[model samples]
Target: MSRLWSPHIESMKREQIEEMQTELLKKQLNYVYHRAPFYQKLYKKSGVKPDDVKNINDLQKLPLTKTGDLQAEMKETGDEYSGRLCVPESELLAVYGPNQHPMPENPLITGITDSDRNTIIQHLARNLIMSGIYSGDTIQSLCWAWEPFNRVYMAANLLISPSVSEILGITPVTLEIIPLEAPRTFATARLLKPSLIIADIGHLTQLAAICQQNNISPEEIGYKTIILKEQRILSEKETKEVSEKWKAKVHNMLAVQDNMLYAEDCNIHNGLHIWEDAFIPEIVDEETGEKVGEGEAGKLAITNLFAKGNPMIRYLINITAKIEKTPCNCGRTHSRLKPQ
Candidate 1:
């Protein structure tokens, strides 16, 4: 009867979570410092060794890495990975670049080993469960697609959808969003009667309009849940409006494409819970690069605890967000991020 995917890990006490994070952080720091060329140079320049970071509290001592730094390194060195890859090339499972318009020639690329990919799938599975997805529920993913291919689709197709299908035992029906094929996609949805819909705001809005043009009620589609892949936080009014429009519960998700980090809102709608076991989230002042006061709004920084390929430590994601340490109504003890 429990909805949690990993109750023991999800319901851990705050202290227990911190203890686990400390252990993982130390291991990750040592792994990256020695293997990842980027981390080695950065730490050497900062005059801080991996052993200097004794605990989570000492994370600020590590220098912050910007996306621009990775891009510049790639451009200058002509190495696709920009020296962030810690694992050997033969061990790589997948590589992804930033999903931007006019994709940069020397874009920042992220590679993952088989272990790294599995860890990402596990985090995504946790997000799906937190967003009300359950076993036996059919998910219809309406994400973007293009000629050269979008990295978001690659994540959804190769990682997200497959995680739901295989790990969670949920049926997945992913469709590439083509303007002319809207009716056919809806027809398939109607035939399948999927219980959950996963898409971004733009695709969902388009689907709503298409349903209207066809004189179809979204409620009649019978999907009771809508998981949105959104970067910015949605307002209460906007969430309510979307839920009303689709007659489904709306859950917002924050997914960073570079490192495949994910966070999702629980039914309580408080904030997106970051998987602390896999990642360490920090909010620091953009100008000072110092930790802000508790619950204070600042740029969001993330450190990958589970990544073995490209270990991102103290990487500022340029999003203004505050971290909430209080326990949630959903009973999960992981820290929540409230993006401004």
Candidate 2:
């Protein structure tokens, strides 16, 4: 049977998904327009108000926010957050940026309130469950530690590891993957005998080579699943090669760093299912900024519907992908993104 963290939301009907998205989008737009100076200026300049967006379809009326726009705003205003921060400095719980260590001059800093952090954790838990994590399963995470560089990567340790341990009764072994620490990592893996491994393809590739050199087999390690922290789609050959080498089910996890968005592949491995309830995704033509048809490849744009701090509206993420609205074999009703 398919594992689900929030079955009702994950398997909701298309109509119900749309209704929830519409309600959340309207509230998010209103919240950003009134509280965030950057969004307020952008909407007023485009002659569109929050009320103009009556539903999800009406979101096209608002202008798109690009990375360049955010940079320009930061350059002009000298604000690190580019005026996208809705919460005050005191209310900010966590702040993330593009680099490992964000400087004061960084243009794209995202701050999250306590509520926003909880929302991220909730969705992240659902994604882990869908990726075949079960209670009592031990997870060995090779992602980065809880640092300022990438919140999603850090979530693998700080948020996901603890949450899964406390709530789902899973044991987590998180290790920061440094080149010199390869021996240590493998030694710990052998000792712990974790059921699942979470790491990027590069790390896995290196580990695989090391295993071969040491006359060790991945199958002997007894990990049943390997979750790849991938930003782009992997070719069929690559996926097959990795799965064969590791003798484990390989799952792709697409993490959009800018918006803190995550989409994970289920057991079927057809595509990465996006958590649409928290994010509004639009596949639009890069040149004309027009919406693309179903299953048509275009730039992936996302709007944060549940984030209370640094909410993004129609932010073009600069990734080409085709959005699939059909139901997944795993019974999830959320749309999937086949990233190109």
Candidate 3:
């Protein structure tokens, strides 16, 4: 049986979801247009008024925001914010960049306001729920080196490293900085017997190989699910191999560096159901900048609805996807995307 974190919103009608998006988007556009010079310039150049975007369809008239635009802004203006700051600098609770690597001077930044932080936490909790993680389940996060994954476990107690005491007490471990090797990871898993393992596909593949070599069955380790945390799609061979080798269900989640977890696979494993309430997703043609047919593959464009401080309107995520509006058997009415 498929479990839902927020059944009401997850099963909300497509039309209703669009209605909510349109309402919030209008306010967001108006707010950014007046406060942020970056958006104001884009709006003025495109000859599109904030009020002109009345519905989701009208969003097509607006130009897509690219990473280069922000880069150029920072280079030209010497502003770390790239002119995307809707609220004052004092109001920002946190800031995020695109990767875990050490950034050069004046890198692109995504500011998080109090509202944005709250929304992110709420949505992240929901994503975990969809992944079948409950409050007491022992989770070992294997997403080593990623900084955003560290903040994703606010509700659940994430252990920095494996602890026999914590595992015996049924508490989870969140591995952020651990090395993705066999000896330490498998040793900890053998000791702690985690219920869920959060790692990308590559790490999981390595772990599975090590388990095979060490004559350790992943099922024997007591993990029920594996949440893959990177952008790449899982092949059928890899999925089956991991499922059989690890003896766990595999879920592919779609996330961005700045936005964190936005979409994830449910128990049904049809496609990654977008957190529509968090961001407005669009499948637009890369060159023409037009919306594609339903279920047709196109570039993924995201408008982070809850990002009030650093409004990302019509931002192209540089990933291709095919969106489906038809509700999945799992009960979520939000559109699903097969991101490539």
Candidate 4:
């Protein structure tokens, strides 16, 4: 089916997206500067006010937020929520601590307001549509690996599972394989005959290794599509190799623990289409903090448009990407990010 989860915004013109982002960015800055202490202090120190930022260009005036800022705030205040939370505990629907970089003493948890959580879920749904994943499709996803401590792929899958199943009515089959057990993974996939496979690059690589061991092609498993979620992009050679080996179409998606679904490739697979309604993406030089021209490579910066509890403004996501201002052949007007 040819459909967009949010047709109007997904098909918006480049100018329209920029205008919308400008409005959202202004509101977000004003909201966070007033409600979030960390942003308030940062903005004040940078001599930038909410009103000072009227458009995306004015974003250069605001200081970039680093992950260490949150940690430093937690260390000093002994309050995990002091820097990031805009609302009271009564208003928050969920609290999440970072799975990576564990600091037990001053562990900070981010509050997800009700609206924020819904935004995350809705964005994930949009990714499914953008990737050409449809309802009623059988999706085989990572469950638990043999090593219990390493559930990186499993955790990501679990996060989006509810939204996919509930909103799209898709059937999700999670595979839990014993450690060093390729046969088990192969068997599970064969039994399910999933049409779509959703997992991180590591898990998919492991499955590819299993395929070699058994002398069985991934195509024999019968999955038509594979979605590899990663913080970085795979090389074109690697992407082509995976598709050739598995006999399936491969799609890459960029996501982080902090932000759920940020960008995903359409069927054309040239670059990832930024979720324009949810995020305003910019490619910038990390040292100078200046916007890189279109088709230029630089660090990926994201501004969350609707996240109330934790507003991300000019936040450097610690990944490098090349921005493509040209429209995607798939008809999504959102800018494309080629993550490196």
Candidate 5:
């Protein structure tokens, strides 16, 4: 089953994406400049105002913020994001964190307040739906190196609603190993021979080896959709070699737990298709803090419109990407993402 929005998003052209960004730029700027103190101070110092910023190009008037700014705020105020939270902490949802850097260094958390938790759950549920995953689809698991973590909880909750409560602390080993007799819990899905195998690329290679050594072809074992991260468990060169060696085109996806949602697909092998409606994204030189010209490589910065809990403007996401003015081969007007 093909995803409903994939075709539309993947085919979107460049002007369309920019047009969408222009439409939302004002609201996004306002959400941050007025509500976020950090942004307000920066805007004031730079002599930029949210109302004066009309289009995406006008964004250059604003100053760029780095992770150090956030660290500084946290060190001084003990709250990390002093100007970020437009709403009370009680209204926030879960914070997703500690992915880019080590757990000790870069940490992030989301606030779960009111129905936002339910909203996030439903949003992810829809995303899985868009990705062609569904209930009763046998799912083999990975990405669980740690217990009592958020990813495990999120995967389970997004896929299984009622029993999401039960998915906590489930061992990754237990999920990887098959049972001889009838298995209960998610074990049943595995025993039933799942339709999907969710593992990083390296794990997939290892699992393929294990199955082959055991004289099992993926077809014989009912292995169908294997979700491997497009980036890689091995080096990029090695991953490409494996793809050629196996004659497989491993699908790539953008899975941001917070700050962004996986609502769009990629075109032209850029990164994920960002929801320009959800965020106003800018690319700039990490060292120089100046805008990188279109198709030029730079760090990825984000200013989200709906983020009331943490109203960050020009928040440095530490990503390097290039802009494309050309339309994608797919066919729509949305600018596709390309991440390095």
Candidate 6:
């Protein structure tokens, strides 16, 4: 069997997470300063040396690497858009250049050619496996993989791998991934009748309706549990109808492209266990870029400590969530995240 993080840096406690991030953050900055010429030039012009980024508090000194900056780099330079690439072109595993932009000098530069994004996923996947999810079970999704949101794909890879790690409870690590798209009723009935369905209730409703129209029994689909993505609002009628139809309990998980899904505890209605072990979370005022107090809702900015392929430090994700005050009843001291 393989392993998650060798010694496993995936499921470290909150305290350990902070200490580890602090160290990695420093190394990341130093790396960018030395390797990425673009960032090195910026540092020279700003009179802000990379060493000046002493800690998370001083991160503000480094200008936020916005999409526009990335664009400017791609337009100006060729394959080496962010001359601040710490790893060499050969070492760069993948780049996640959103389709919103024009074609890069080289397509690969924009994609995660290096393992930076992979490293981040390893941390999150290990956490997901440890949180819940056994090897014997199966996972299904309506989402696409490796294109837009590679996190889901990365997660699937982590689960299906046979590895030994303290991060995830999955020792043997063998699972199946069934990607479901439109005309899903026919597709699912024919193929992925999985035990675990990772989609929202609305998605489930759509699936059920499709199945009913096709004359397939809902039970035949076999969804023992469903991972619910947080909804904007819930109607009483909708809630009641959902409860009676499926035999599974719905779990609302907090996930976003910018902020990887995590919470304060394994089970907390409001707070999502923050993956501090990989993602360094900061709740700041939307306009002012100032930190908000605990239990307050503010803009969410995440610094992926492990992402070397494509690193984002304090990149504004445009989410406002509150930090839960009390430690989760689940008995972990790590802080939790709840949407504002």
RMSD of each: 3.0, 2.9, 4.2, 4.0, 6.2, 6.0
* Best model number under lDDT: 1
Which sections of candidate 1 miss by over 4 Å? Answer: 145-162, 177-181
| Cα lDDT, model 3, residue 146 | 40
Across 202-272, the per-residue lDDT of candidate 1 in tens digits comes to 77777777788889887777778988876666677878988998889999877686766878889898988
- Please list all clashing residue pairs in model 2, or write none if there are none: none
What is candidate 2's lDDT per residue for 146-250, written digit by digit as tens? 432234322344543334355666777777765655666688888888988877777876777777778988677777898887667666677778799889988
Q: How many steric overlaps does candidate 6 have?
A: 25
TM agreement with the true structure for every prediction: 0.92, 0.91, 0.88, 0.87, 0.70, 0.71
Q: What overall lDDT goes with each candidate model?
A: 0.79, 0.78, 0.74, 0.72, 0.51, 0.53
Separate clash counts for every candidate: 0, 0, 1, 1, 23, 25
Q: Looking at model 1, report the run of 10 residues with the lowest lDDT sum.
A: 146-155
Q: Give me candidate 1's TM-score against the actual structure.
A: 0.92
Q: How far off is model 1, as Cα RMSD? A: 3.0
Which candidate do you rate higher for lDDT, 2 or 3? 2
User: Stretches of candidate 4 above 4 Å error?
Assistant: 99-108, 143-162, 175-185, 212-215
* lDDT against true structure, model 4: 0.72
Residue 273 CA error for candidate 4 (Å)?
0.7
Error of 2 at 240 (Å): 1.9
| Candidate 3 regions with alpha-carbon error over 4 angstroms | 100-106, 144-146, 152-170, 177-183, 209-215
**Better-scoring candidate (TM-score), 3 or 6:** 3
